[model samples]
Target: MDEGINSSTPAWLTEEFIEAILREDEKTQHLQVARADVQPAVAKGDNFGGLLHRVTAEIYYQNNGNNQEKSELRCIIVKSLPSDDWYREVLDQAGVFKREMRMYKVILPAMYKLLKEKLPGVTIPALTARTYTSSITNETLVLEDLRPLGYRMVDRRQQLDLEHCVVALRALAQFHALSVALNDRDPSLMDHFREGFYTPERRHILSPFLQPTLDTLASAVEKWPEYERFGDKIRQIAATSVDRIIDVVKPKNNSLCVLNHGDFWINNILFRYHPKNGKVLGAKFVDFQVSRYSSPALDLQYFIYTSAKEDVRDKSLRHLLQEYHASLTHTLQLLGCGKYAITFGELEQEMKERAFFGLITACTYLGAVLADPSEVVDLDSNFGEESRKNGGQSPMEKAYAGERFRKIFRKFLIHFENEGLL
Candidate 1:
């Protein structure tokens, strides 16, 4: 029996199967296993995909006497759910393990295989191992870590030049086009794979977080008299927008619903530089825990709002949308789905309607939470606990956060006025 295999493996994962997988890797021999201290790592940021507890360690092959033939190997990541009680609750409530297993094991692999077979130049993460231990609360996925490929994570506030945006948009267009082509070629396969992934119910799961944040925003907006006229508009939209957003995305019969990197924000994307010119070579996406079947517009809206800075958001909006449409059209033609995929006009209409979804939600909800100084429970003693308590952001930080919120909000309202859609 493989050291990690047990009867408790989910039905989708079996002991015979796990042993076969471990056998394929002959380089490493298991030595000792230990748990990692995860608190320091957690302090880094709250946004690194899933919530992790302590990290688990698996010590493998080592070499000795002659240094020429020797190497030490170990794999470490925050302990997954199967090993931690805290994470188990999180996985249970979110159903993270089961849902992601389906995505990684079935959907993503199929997509990668198809893309590799058709367009070899396209880049995507290569799946490695998917192992589940019932005893531990979390599932362990050994994947090709892209960090080794010279990809680095970027902060949302970092500004991207036009060239970088264009490259990324082209990649996104190809990704969406691949899905459109797959659906057109075999509608049944697309339906079967995407059925459970895209539903209105997922929105409800997010409501607990959304509703409170909206209420908080509603309170904060009262202080800004300049925004008073728009207050009711924001409130009305915030209250019912979750369901409306979902309704807007519900597909209408083989409409180009693709595998979207559900959280297409800056952090989830990794970028690398070219060796000679030091220019951004390309970007690779990761953290697929939120991967779902939704209109490509969802990803577009998210990428624009979270990835682009204020100037880009304000000045380059139309240009970026046009760029995305062009990329989509080109990729569809390459994949032979041009006839079935959406036209530039249709994409524009959808973007106009749905572009505000992420912006509105983030501003009205996240804005309030981020602006509130009390949210930061701890900081260096130099910052002073009293100053850091309950919406403790510095005045400058709060102002910047507020400005971002208002900018997006004002744009949406002005757009509604111009389009006669409000």
Candidate 2:
């Protein structure tokens, strides 16, 4: 452990705070901290798409007892709001930060408790990192650092293979199933989760960024020969893009709705592999900031469009969908929510009905997904006064203009056009 902490460490992350967090995480009140070291958990470009800043705290602690306590090291990840006021205010208005805090502090614990009581003896896969503590006032969350537990994030530049996709889908299915069961137990369980990235109410907050980005994308596409038609489609979509998103995300009557991981993609998912064979064993999700109570189809579409490999995205999509459906149904049955589970036909229909979500997500996020690590833009610099000074050509816009992003986006554009979504 470092004798001195990093200068950039948050004021709230004191030795006392670390002691309290360790107590909660270890479930042992006798743990007393000797010292702690705090440093950035991820590199600048690594978590560029994430809104919150992350730091890891290493605590060297001892058990308070007469039997000769020995110091041990424990690591935890702290997620906090960005220091930039402009970015903070935008996210504050969107209510993502508080919502995520609630997700960890309230929703997940209740869901897990319910499962433990109702399905005793059933083994549930760990669907997310454990939250040791959180503070709405502090705008911070202390979570179990999954890296030390062998959970690894798939590289942003690389897409998920079949094994990884299956693991992710299984975890997502269980997550959605548990959410549905909890909602059924108490219909208002997710009242606070009603609003997410695509709500009509948040259009004002999102349009300023969405419209211009689409304009840049459309302008780029216009220069390509056969791609000019997609540029026209992009222009039309950009004119009322928010409205289109709201339409797709709005709750419909008689649909299989579950809590949507509003930003489900490769970046938000982590997988643990089998020790000997290196096969994916399980998956965990992170960043609940944009989680919304919407159709499961939204998450499915978002995952397929943003994270799947080219072969899977283009050819093996249905196979992946089948895997997700099987997992969803199996989980639903296990949780006594079998009646709420939709058939493969119904799931397919729902995904097809909301196919526009795939296009909407692709237009906005696909560039970030395909961008090289070096090409990734810092989230704050892209949004703050820097972008205005760049004449709206922020580092993000330039990333979207990159040849790799354009070429990959072109594939989706063609697919969407063929599917009549464009």
Candidate 3:
């Protein structure tokens, strides 16, 4: 039985569409972008995490602003809606595509401009991108690729090291700090973006992903006698955590809130390292599909818990937390709101409470994240045709059920529970 599932490239990345995005910038007005070779930014057919292809564009433009010579620009990356109809619909209905477009087109520029004007000494790294459509039918976002400059994700399967943590934590601090500055400058500055924050209704998107991961985790933890009860408890929570995760993003009085890059794991980040010595220099954040107005704790907890290598997390969590807060304090000070900096004490309290974000990140994400090549599930089958038929234990469930991921899940559960988080 063949299901006529429609999955292909977005119709809007054509040369004509590319030209219009170029027209958005005053600096590029002198040039016309006719056509370019677009290649998958990660790998062919790999949408990375969010059903969006990370793509790089090779563009040649004729300089007409000065009637000068034409030039080829190689500094751009583009993201487009998945060709898969189901992925498109899910992302669209959940406001994922819209939020990311708004991030690139609206929030990012506003935050950058505010940073430059309000805190001259502050440095914030941003992606230079043009967004075409928030419409799920033809969503497109063009971004500046930083890889040519020697920045990329640390090996995804490898545990992130102290250096990676230091760079990521500090950058996250600055990024969140800027959000505070944006809010302080004008309480309304973030109003537009806040509308895109995750909501309970968006839980529909998680349904396809959750239970299978829970089953996988449950099976993995079965060997650990200590985690025996948690296997069932995790299954229970994983089902309900969709709504719970959204609920956690809501308002809390007295706690300072900022726009969160809701998905703060390693793959969503890029790092620039020193050429001569291989020391990590800085980091840049990408992917704001799930970004929203919420306690900064959401991003902080998600990053440290899910992305840190086990040893790094066990040994350096305290140091990294301090580093994160130090950067936050200084950035807030530069924003002239030192008094409003969430104290390290307050931050810890918040992180403890929001510990589930990391767990959710682990269960919902790490299966696909940590899967071996031979183990990779064809998401199209489970999420597409199969879900439409009768969805139970899926290939995704089986793909993630490997012993390695199970142990990883068990470790996360044990950690959270030890902290009184579960």
Query: What is the C-alpha local distance difference test score of each model?
Result: 0.53, 0.79, 0.68
Q: Name the lDDT value of residue 5 in candidate 2.
A: 64
Give the Cα error of residue 336 in candidate 1, in Å: 3.4
Query: lDDT-based ranking, best first?
Result: 2, 3, 1
lDDT of 1 by residue, 262-366 (tens): 666665566888879978877766556655566787888777755666567678878887888888887777666678667778887777666556555455333
lDDT of 1 at 331: 70
lDDT (Cα, tens digit) per residue for candidate 2, span 380-422 = 7667765666765555666676777877787888889899877
In what order do the candidates fall by TM-score, top score first?
A: 2, 3, 1
What is the overall TM-score of model 3 with all chains considered together?
Answer: 0.84
Tens digits of lDDT, candidate 3, 1-422: 01211233344555555555655543454455534655446642234434443333334555433433555654556666655567667767767777777777767787788878886876655633334432333356666667787788776667589998888888888888888887887787576556343565655556556665666666656656666788777777866766777777675888888888888888788888899999998888788887877788888877775678878877888899899999999988987778788778998898777777777777666766666666666656556755657854465565466665666766777787786656
Native-to-model Cα distance after best TM-score fit, residue 230 in candidate 1, in Å: 2.6
RMSD values, in order shown: 8.0, 2.6, 4.9
TM-score per prediction, in order, is 0.70, 0.91, 0.84
Clashes of each: 17, 0, 4
